[model samples]
Target: MKKAEVVLIPIPAMGHIVALVEVAKLLVERDDRLSTTIFIMHPVLDPSTTKYTESLAASTLPDRMRVVNLPNLESNTEDTKDRNWLNSMIESQKPRVEEYVSKMRTQSQLSPDSPQLAGFIFDTFATGMKDVANGFGVPWYVFSASGAAFICSMFYLQALHDGEGVNLTEFKNSDALLEVPGLANPLPAKLLPSMVFREDLLAIFLEHARTLKETRSILVNTFLEFESYAVHSLSNGKNPPVYPVGPMVKHVADGRDLRSDESNKYRDIMEWLDDQPPSSVMFLCFGSWGSFCGKQVKEIACALEHCGHRFLWSLRKPSSQKGKIESPSDYLNFQEILPEGFLDRTLEIGKVIGWAPQVDILAHPAVGGFASHCGWNSILESVRFGVPVATWPLYAEQQFNAFQMVIDLGLAVEIKMDYWRDFLGDNEIIVSSDDIVKAIKHVMEEDSEVRKKVKEMSRISEKSLKDGGSSFSSLGRLIEDMIDNIS
Candidate 1:
């Protein structure tokens, strides 16, 4: 019997790429009949990123794994520039997919039969890869870098099939409750990701959702027990088979030791965290794509001051504006996006940096709560760290994720805004700043029952990732299913 040759394609970003590396390692250690190869795509690979990838590859079973680096097609250009993120993503992927297909074909020429490319594992944003896989007549599996709840939401295809279209504008006046077939709770239109409201992007997402049904399977980077509602919902119904194999960081659980001695950049953040009191610091971050206008930044700063908490805030310059270093007072140019005097007032208890070691910071004892944009990756990390969440959901599936945290799971408290109508582009709906203050206080303050509940939920989250746990069993089952299907 010939061993299978699996080609894994991972999107850029530390979190996105690591899961695939872990899965490849798992496949090699579990079976002698399987061999794996990794193909990485990104703008630039730094030494830190390279070391992390190499460590995973090297630590895995020898001789069964291979790592390949492909030229990044979009390296010369700015990712956050005016390029339509959706269209740019589709166009950029075409060349890379073509390149991979070309390489596979070339490999087949060297050996008459090169084990017939068993499968292609892709990141969530790599929708075009499915077409390439289909072209090559191989199985394609979407590897979600987030939680099961996030992917389950994508599988609800009734709205797409009903010809309702993917625009939120269409559902603006719709008060009708939507029954997501496999979810534990009814999904309100307000809870959907902001992108779902945009007809063009929504169409693209729905198309991907449709493709999910046609693909080999959907693999989520999560454990079964952590999101049982979502996992079960996606599994039992008309939805495609869902595989939960996660907390992928288990392979890199050794902490700061994973950071190579060559660059001490990560050392500064880790050292600062060591001095803070246990569960006293608030960890604030928006993922790589998350940015705020200067006005919103000021308001957040004001809120942080009012909360009186020691916090580490990750502040990236606003991507909407380029080559400008405007202060919080530059409200006129930034369109009231941030609150005034936010920085001057909060300097005492807050340390703001461009980026921070999020996972390491969260796992630190001093970190008590997270104020986040509610990205699924951030949410999962928060849960793993046993930190409570103060939800400030932004675009994409963040709104849905925030809603699920606050309303469905009761694991987080939602920050309110008085200008909800202004922010939402809906004049009728009103939200207030008082809501924000209250929610933040509830999550950060020790007296609040909600804070206690989050701590308990955190423990449950930790248990799911342990050996022989729900997540562990699910991963084993997923590997078995893949092997069985191939054989």
Candidate 2:
């Protein structure tokens, strides 16, 4: 039998890349006749994203699977705040990506040992490739690096806007509750998604939503039992199938670790955790799309200091770090950028570093709480490790994830629960030191309600991955279905 060579086009960001890479690994692990070629698009500003991709390329992956970085020719004309740039930049890569895939297909077909092009699998942001996949007469699948609720929300938003001619932005500022079928709690219109904030992004985001119907299936990075309502809402006989094969972070038990490449940077972090008592440290991290500003970082420093909680913060610089270099304040160390005497005063109690071993830290016994941006991947990781959260969302359905995690799952405490934080714009959030202090205490204090719930949820998360379990069965079916699609 001929093997299926699936070309994966990920959304060129760290979070999206990590999720789809795990899917590729899962696909290869379960099938002898399958292989993947992940075509990574070049990301903006952050050199770490590029380096991370390159590291994956250089790593020892399975022979049937490999990584290829697309050319860094994408234009950087658009400002980071104008997120339409991402949609546009991804759109601009279509002709080049299609051309590259066509060439790859030609070369591989000339060799008998090389696999036939089974299809293309793209991250939700790379949905423009749907046309390319159709042009080549092959299957295309969309991988949503979020939960089932998010998938339903996006598609439902498109249907609502296009079908009814309603203004989603208008609803965003209104007091109405969003009624997505699968979620038990009503999603506030204000917390819908960052794309709703800008009128220009509507076309592209809807492009992502509408194209899902054209694909063979929708693959989400979530488990079945966890998001049953949202997953169920996505299912109908006529619509594309939805599959859940996730909580797919890498770990030693899987004989693989995603952050192995960053082992050197994280070794120190692990050693620091070793010295702390069990369940004593609060681990703080925001997703790539949302990092604290210097002013906000200082506030966090002050909060950590005042609250007297032992903590480990995985800090990220703003994306436009190069632009900030003109100022003497933008230094190499976070300590350099922090408030006067902040580091010295809290040196023993809280350690703030520029990067961290996130999964490793969550798995560490000393980490009791996660003050997170509530990205779906982070939520899953925290749950898997029995770490409760202080929901502090930044952007892009993160508020949706945060609200759901707190209201729907009862696994987290709230930091700034009701509001939406745009991309450091007019309506951007400024979380005060006092609020942070309260939130951290709610998460880290022993025998808190959130902690007890998270511990229970963690057991459920683990059990779902076991054989004959809901997630396990779902994954088995997903693999079987993909194999059937190959024929």
Best by TM-score: 2
- Candidate 1 lDDT over residue span 343-372, tens digit each: 566666666665566777787788888888
Computed on alpha carbons, the lDDT of every model, listed in order, comes to 0.65, 0.79
Note the residue pairs that clash in candidate 2.
182-229
Candidate 1 residues lying further than 4 Å off, grouped into runs, are 11-15, 29-33, 42-67, 74-116, 157-160, 163-168, 172-176, 250-255, 258-265, 320-348, 417-434
TM-scores for all candidates: the values are 0.78, 0.90
lDDT of 1: 0.65
Number of clashes in every candidate structure?
Answer: 13, 1
Worst 10 residues of 2 by lDDT: 322-331
Candidate 1 weakest lDDT stretch, 10 residues: 417-426
> For model 2, how does the per-residue alpha-carbon lDDT over 1-487 read when each residue is reduced to its tens digit?
6677888988766788888888888788767888988888765445557777877877788768988777767374546556577666776777877888788789888987776778888888888767788898888888889898888888789889999887887866668887876688888788888777678777677877888778888888887777877888888675689887778776546555434545665667777888999999998988655566677878888899999989998776554444331111123776656899988898889888766657778888999999998988899999889999999987778888998898987889999976554444334567899999999988898998889888987887888778876777777776666566656
